[model samples]
Target: MPQANIDPAIKSVHVFSTGAGEQHKEHRYGSPLPRLLWALTSQSWIKIPVNAFVIEHRDGLVLFDTGLDPAIKSDPNYINSAIGRFLLRRIFRLHIGPDERLHKKLEAMGFAAADIRKAVISHLHFDHVGGIADIPQADLLVSKDEWAQLSAPHPEREWILREHIEIPGAKWRPVEFAPTDDPLFAPFGGSYDVMGDASMILLPTPGHTPGSMSMLVRTGDTPPLLLVGDLTYQADLLMKDQVPGTGDAKLLRSSFAKVRTLKKQFPDLVILASHDPETADILAASHSSRP
Candidate 1:
């Protein structure tokens, strides 16, 4: 799409890290050893940011994903299941401060949690939806397929905690993607236009999770931004067709191919991943550069 044809509803895009976490090198760069082997025995670790994005649209503020909750560090009973808690300790190490909470992060950025009109969740991972409770008034848009996982037996095993997501007074809306005739988005088969203005379109990426999705932000003159949550830890990894240690390998490759195709269509497209350590700098450069 031409820059002139892009939507101008988006005024600016910003990102904030709720906190940082340490993951095994295998978990991030991939490993030959099985997940359990690495999770249980690997001593190598890499610190990564738990990031969330803010899109300043003319109509209202929008969040790509809510970052990690501080409660996970403060509350011993954050994860309900004993096994889940044990596995979490072995799998990752989190570093979050009270001020890093979603509301506080937004407030520091000159935005209020109440001012948020919509939060397009990329997936149901605890870190992704951690801030939902802070923004109860906003419509939480999650992929229908992702939301269905909650009904599956022992969802917590997959790290989808019901207590936090199904919390009282939270507005969770399952999104059903509709078929789009637009050539640019036809490969995705369907899309959900968040504002019904083509400013932000949600595409089913699915790989990191069964129903994971990505948001395409067309901000007129600037390069288009794709908020790909956990699709790949790094854009370079996705470009190289490298799969991470977790998630379904087959699905990850398929989604990676689709995103690559979109990148081909728009050479200047900026792919942002939730935990990619370099995303903040890349986003800043993308905003500073002209299309």
Candidate 2:
């Protein structure tokens, strides 16, 4: 979309880190065999931040994704499956304080869990949906494909725990992306305009997971922002067509190419991955020109 076509309702955007975790370096980059070998033998770790974004729009506060749940570290049964529990320990090391709970984290960020109107879940990964329990009143939005995983024989096998997701009183909505005539989004094929005004849109990027999605945010003053949840660990990797150790490699490449096309069309477009270690510096630099 052209810079002139931006909306004015969006006042500002803020990025927050709910918690931090460490994964094998190979897991953040390279092929599955290397990742497995590194996981099995190498102690080299890469710190990744579990991020959630808040958009201050005219309508209300909208959250791109909810960060990790602190309970995963303290509660023994967090993963449920015996194998999952063992695997989780080997795959990632998480560090979250008692104050890192979503509610408290939001409070620290000058917002409240109760104030969130809707939360767009990029995918149903356990870490991404962990904060849903804290914001029960907010409308939890997920792609139809992502939500469909819940009905599968065992969502936990894919690391999406149904038990944690199907919490009582939580309002979950599965949304279908509609075909769009808009040229800017034509490359994406389909999109869900979150605010009706096109200030925030949900685009199906897939790859990281079959139902994985990304959010596009545009405002009059700031350059366009794409909140891609694990589409790539880093924006540079997407630009270089490098697929991570996990997910469908073929699908990931397709999504990466499309995102690069969008970036080419809008060079100033900021691609923020949920776990990108440099997200804070990138976001701060993007807004440095303003007061």
Candidate 3:
């Protein structure tokens, strides 16, 4: 039986990157920062589209990341947490109108947030999981170890939140892939295969954080798409093998290197970068019907 819920006509698919800013506007374009870190990307902010995905397979539907907090659009300067949030909308030169939240967009497309059965997180960063609250019935997926790390985090680790992880009444499913150092597909080795449905697989890319993952969507036996969350802020950087501009240079460096190799090996995979503007172009072109 063809899955009635998921639009199977769109066999292999992707979601567009929605955000409020640009990448390396300081470095490639021009800004007032002297060092690469501050110049390339804001350590305190990023103008990235929370890249999310929706996959339709024979059995079910799978969602990638949930995206940024809809609240930011209301009060682009509303980061009332302890660490205090950077006004990304202002920093990115984005003017968030009242109507721009993921759920709004989803509802507009004739789908509700609760319709999502599974969601794969690249990492637990706020921008990635900010819309988690909007997704009511999803079996939220992330590395089990990563969840632990997010909860019992290292000191001064100003990113993740316990509330996001332990949302009351949410169906959170922690997935682990450490024991199997096997390649995501087979023969190759390094991640966990979400054991087919042509659904989603979680790659164990632990660098952007302790359990960063790149989502692999298998539409068919011949090809797939790789939605890497913050793996490389830009696909151009990953293609160039250049060390990415990240919070921790060294950690990001190592992670960047591995993904670079993966890209080299599987060039056919449709790759998406959360903050990269290019992803919007690619995804829009791929599924113009939805956008």
Candidate 4:
């Protein structure tokens, strides 16, 4: 779709981290070792941001992801299941202060948590949904495929905790992608426009999880952005077709190809992964050079 055809309802896009964490190098990049083996034995660790993006749309404030919850550190029973808790310790070393909570992060940005009208959840991962509690009034949007995992036997095994997600007063909406003739999004099969004006569109890019999706932000003069949550740790890796250690390899490749095709269409596309540490800088630079 041409830029002129779509209204520029988005004022700005901002990114902030609720916290940071250390994951094994094998997790970020590809590894031959099995996920369990690497989680237990890998010595290499990479620090990553637990990022969330705030889109200043004409309607109201929208969030791409909620970032990590501080209770995961302060509360012993955060994961509930003993085995889940044990596995989590081996997988991640989180560094989040009480002040780094979602509401506090938004406050620092001069926004109230209540100002969030909707949050387009990239997936049902803990880190991505952690801040939902802080914004009970906002609608939490997740792809229908991703939400189906809750019905499966053991979603918690995949680090999808129902206790936190199915909380009281939480507005969880399952999004179904509709057929679109728009050539730019046709390769993705379908899409869900977060805002009616198409300032932001959600595309199903599963592989990181069954229901994983990414957001495409097209505003006025700023470069277009794809807010990919854990599809890849870094944008360059996705460009190289490098699959992470976990998730379905076959499916990841499929999603990677679609995103790569999108990049070719919009040469200046800014691909921002949720955990990519360089996201904030890249976002700033993209806007700084905007025509």
Alpha-carbon local distance difference test for all models:
0.92, 0.88, 0.60, 0.93
lDDT of 2 by residue, 100-215 (tens): 88888888889888999999999999889989988988999999999998888888978899988999999999999999887778888899989899899899999988999999
Pairs with backbone N, CA or C atoms under 3 Å apart (clashes), candidate 3: 18-49, 19-49, 182-190, 183-188, 183-189
- The alpha-carbon deviation from the true structure for residue 202 of candidate 2, after best TM-score superposition, in angstroms, is 0.5
Model 4: CA > 4 A from native:
none
Task: For model 1, give the 10-residue run with minimal summed lDDT.
Answer: 1-10
lDDT (Cα) of model 3: 0.60
Q: What is the TM-score of each candidate against the true structure?
A: 0.98, 0.96, 0.75, 0.98
Candidate 4 local lDDT, 84-189, one digit each (tens) = 9999988999989877889999999998998999999999989999999999999999999999999999999999999999999999999999999988899999
| Model 1 TM-score relative to the real fold | 0.98
- Quick one: RMSD of model 3? 5.8
Question: For residues 15-61, could you state the per-residue lDDT of candidate 1 as single tens digits?
Answer: 89998999999999899989899999999889999999999999999
Candidate 1: which stretches are off by over 4 Å? none
Full ranking by TM-score: 4, 1, 2, 3
Model 3 poorest ten-residue lDDT run? 1-10
Kindly give the number of clashing pairs for every candidate: 0, 0, 5, 0
Quick one: ranking by lDDT, best first?
4, 1, 2, 3
Off by over 4 Å in 2: 32-38, 289-291
RMSD (Cα, Å) of model 4: 0.9
lDDT of 3 by residue, 1-291 (tens): 212222223365656444565444443322445434464355454455556766655445567787776565565344445333442322344433455566776676556676766778878876677677777787788877677775574422445756555678777778866444434333223455553533456776665676777876644443446788877767677666554534445666666566666655555556777777678677655443321
